[model samples]
Target chain A: MKRDLFIIMFISSILIFPMTVEEIFDKVDENMVYKNMKFTARMNILEYNENRELSMDIFMRDENNILIEILASSSGHTNRFMKKNDQMWLYIPNAGKAIRIKGHMLKEGFMGSDFSYEDMSENRKTNDLYNMELLSKDTLYIIKLTAKSSDAPYKMKMVYIKKDIFIPIREEIYSSSERLLKELIINEYKKIGEKYIPINILMYDKLKQNSRTEIVYEDIKMNAGIDDKYFQKSYFER
Target chain B: MKKIFLFLIIIPYIIFALRFSGEYNYNYYYYQSLNAYGENRVILNMNADKGIASFHLQGLGQFYIGGPKYIIPYPDNIPNYVIDNLPSYYQLSNSMKINTAYLSIYYLGFNLKFGKFPMKWGISQTYAPADIFSSTSPMDYSYIEEGILGFLGMYSFGDNTISFIYQDHTDYEQTKQGLLFENINNYFTASLFSAHFFNTRRIFNGFVFRTNTVEYLLSGFNIITDYWGPGIWIEIDYFADVEYWIQDSIADYSHYFLIAGVDYTFNDLLYTSLEYIYYSEGKTDGFTYNDILRRYLNDNFLISKHYLIPIIGINQGETISGEFAAMINANDLSSMIMTSLIYQPREYLSMDLNSSFVIGNLGKDFYGLPPIYTFQLKFYY
Candidate 1:
């Protein structure tokens, strides 16, 4: 009987010691967050009977500042978007000046893609914004997250994470009214240094019919030593 | 001639390190006045960019049929003195012309620019009192700003910057130098500009202020709490000992011009803005038609005593967008309304349909202007 009790206690400790949902999220954030990063990406926006592709170069500093520039396009013009803290600005080559953009504009589609400006702008830590719970244990760990604040882009999200990698494989975003808004599926991921990053992300807007945006990241470098000058509004012209 | 040769020599070096890009645009327009007229235009834009150096060149070719004699008004024969002093590269022709050619270099956190390029100052998008460099053509709806031949140097620090610009207009026997200081912070942004004109013996100074704030509950979004909010901007320009050609003589005066504007967006789908401008130097009364014409021709003063502008825009996802803008001359009770529809069938191709209507008494502001409808096809490479 004493041996049986010992085995049961050992099993209980084993269950209790496994990382909690909150801890798992923290781990994920730690792996993903960076001081600065630079990457080149191609966005393929697919709609019914049509497809559009654009190339962009992105520089991100800390978690609040981001600068994006459209690579040379057929139109012979370059457009830039910069987000510093709470302010966002857009610069068009012809406009000759950067125009301040409202925060609500962050909810709209980015350059006619499924990704909204808010989705691309802020890099909030999952553990800070959402309350996570383990939904199931299988080849992949399914987790359900409820937003802690109404300011979040989505009220609820269901994420499927790889058990060993601590990275999300798929996610479903729901609005406050409990309507499914978007679905993001990670098609491919590359191990860069010590972190796992999604190289190809396919996002679908559930409200839109026959539409999807595929973002493929290439030549991504973390801790890229980007200068602070890049975060300034004047840098938009550069 | 020496400057042209210097530019030519630098062109190959810029091209060697540059990546080239640009677009071709074609537009057709029909106008209804006493007689119907049609205008066709094609524009080519080229840009060559290296790491810290770049060049932009634009060429425009146009043809008109039917109504008006000229699609774009040609400057009445420039005085011989003005022509003789003009830059050799400056050319005026009947059909085609090079619209812009400029080179810019960025070195050691300092930006140096030369040639002809658009220089913008002020916070207001529609009417900027501090924008003393280039005067926008009242009749032109294309919003294609003409370049100013100048040199500019700028240095930036944190969220602030200081720039100096020296503009050369030898043809007019005038030169302008301006100093501008700008700062941006979390709550507000402001700019101060001061310009001195040598030939006119006038000094112009102005300041632009803008603030943006978000109202969490007022935005009416259930999930998104931080809406874009409302933006308010004001600009005021003060001229010291300005001279204006009125009736046939020069009138010297010191006055202030002001512009105030507000803009907001709804749920990121709709946008609306309103602006009011007060021109202190504008003619109040006792101005004859020929006097107005002469002042515009000789001194290039186009401001009215009071002006009101309203603009609205709607975006339907990524496929369609529409905009309506109106400029109302409050004093004369005249207005011009412009409406445009943009459709993107594909990622790199877009079609624009635009229309303009003028309303008021004949010979009044925007009253005698003809109605215009335009269709444009743009392709990006």
Candidate 2:
């Protein structure tokens, strides 16, 4: 019991001492809040017991955190989108029409993870649900997060060590049922401009199936002069 | 001790899920009447289905060419007797494009999804055209259309992935009437109904005097690589529903369903699945659309599709596959035999031939000849 207390204090010292959530936010440029960015990326899909396949793409993004258009390998099979608040629209090249999508059917698989449609959007914030408690320190700070609501997506998320010089090292999420569903492991990090964002993210879903996804970013330009019109409905049609 | 422990283990999880979860989807499908059996007919049908997974966009749209074709040849000739007619069968055009996109951060055990995808409601698996198992005739089924919107919550545990899906029930309600006609309105559709709002309208004023709200529950999990390891799936589903509508003089009610299945890969050349479902239709208020369509379509096509089912499928490499599904009931009057042969000519193109026959008085008479046959050609990128 005494040992347990010492361990807990040690964890607290690492997480609470250097960087608070507000401190991390303060470092970013306020003007960067809504700038659109463009990037080229190599996307890899790896499922349990499956081979890893690759897809290449050039993506357009807005500062508002919207994924605007994806030019997939040239041909018009590529798709585009416009997202604002609760409304979303898609442009299909073959159909020659753009349609609106709405309702609760959004819980299906995305690119093939247990991740649902709603899991991919930019909404809510970490402070909305979690009270992060520091756990340890080395180069990274380990934190323990408990949910504010019983129905919160995760009962607990053991976010890996967040280092001052790099993006998060690893993260483990548990269901209220206390089951581990997925793991995100970041192996490589590069300093882009002023911020050190994760250039590569590897996600593994535990439903024990052959479903995993890896996204590698390259030629990333953040807070470049991009227009909101780039995220407009017409942009998706283009 | 074991039973109490089990209860203790499950109760908290249930409580946790009940208090927190929500989703919305826009599911849409169009039916093209391709064949006709008796008097039911649709000359052309098309559909569009849209959805959000997590909160991103997902969609499937297609057009069809034929209609349902079922016909009974009556003795001698009786005027005004449409009992033996077949509906049109619509040859479906390949989906213009199936688009999937999302922007949620997915890492480790937690998935933050924000896109579109379908909810597992109606037992029909095809994006449109309904389940080949339940349709009165191929053409009688509705084609895929509509879409859903909402976010998704995903948890990855051990070797399993658990998903808590909450979507607005309104869109699911739009399919309730169609489900009633299809007789698939048991726990599956009923649970979808639990998420719907019902209202009574005045024709002249277009006023909704009252609106009813319902609750739906869905628990889905898939095990990929635990004990059995990758390329394998062992899942069991238990779902329930409750509906409350004051204007229709409807009382609150609920029902339950159970289904379990496993998918496994053998060697590098074959994949297979064995699934069993135990379903109860719950309280039937006599002649729902399900009953009417059942009798109408059965008389015209000699097919009966309501019952418990066990299914098996085999996938050989990437280009060839087959499936067989049989329905078992206390009375032989309701059994089914179905099989399909699929061959992939290329990575992007394939062909299939399928045959389905219900074991009614008519199908039993044919010992040497198969009752139904279907041919299909497909292309995809």
**DockQ top scorer:** 1
Choose the strongest candidate by lDDT. 1
User: Which window of ten consecutive residues has the lowest lDDT sum in model 1 chain B?
Assistant: B215-224
RMSD of each: 9.2, 18.6
lDDT of 2 at A156: 81
When summed lDDT is taken over every stretch of 10 residues in candidate 1 chain A, the lowest stretch is A70-79
lDDT by residue for model 2 (A1-238), tens? 9999999998898668856753433332231232355656655665445443433333335322355344332111344554443344455533333543322223333333344434444334555556677677565667777888532446688876555453567879776676886787877767666666666777777754566777787767776655443443223332
Q: Write the per-residue lDDT of candidate 1 for residues A109-153, one digit (tens) a residue.
A: 777789988887767788777888899877887999998965566
TM-score for model 1? 0.78
TM-score of chain A in every predicted structure: 0.89, 0.69
Off by over 4 Å in 2: A1-35, A48-65, A73-77, A88-107, A113-120, A123-125, A149-155, B1-78, B81-139, B142-381
Model 1 Cα shift for residue A159 (angstroms): 3.9
Over 4 Å off, model 1: A1-25, A44-55, A74-76, A103-113, A126-158, A173-182, A205-212, B5-10, B17-21, B65-94, B198-228, B242-251, B283-304, B330-333, B362-366
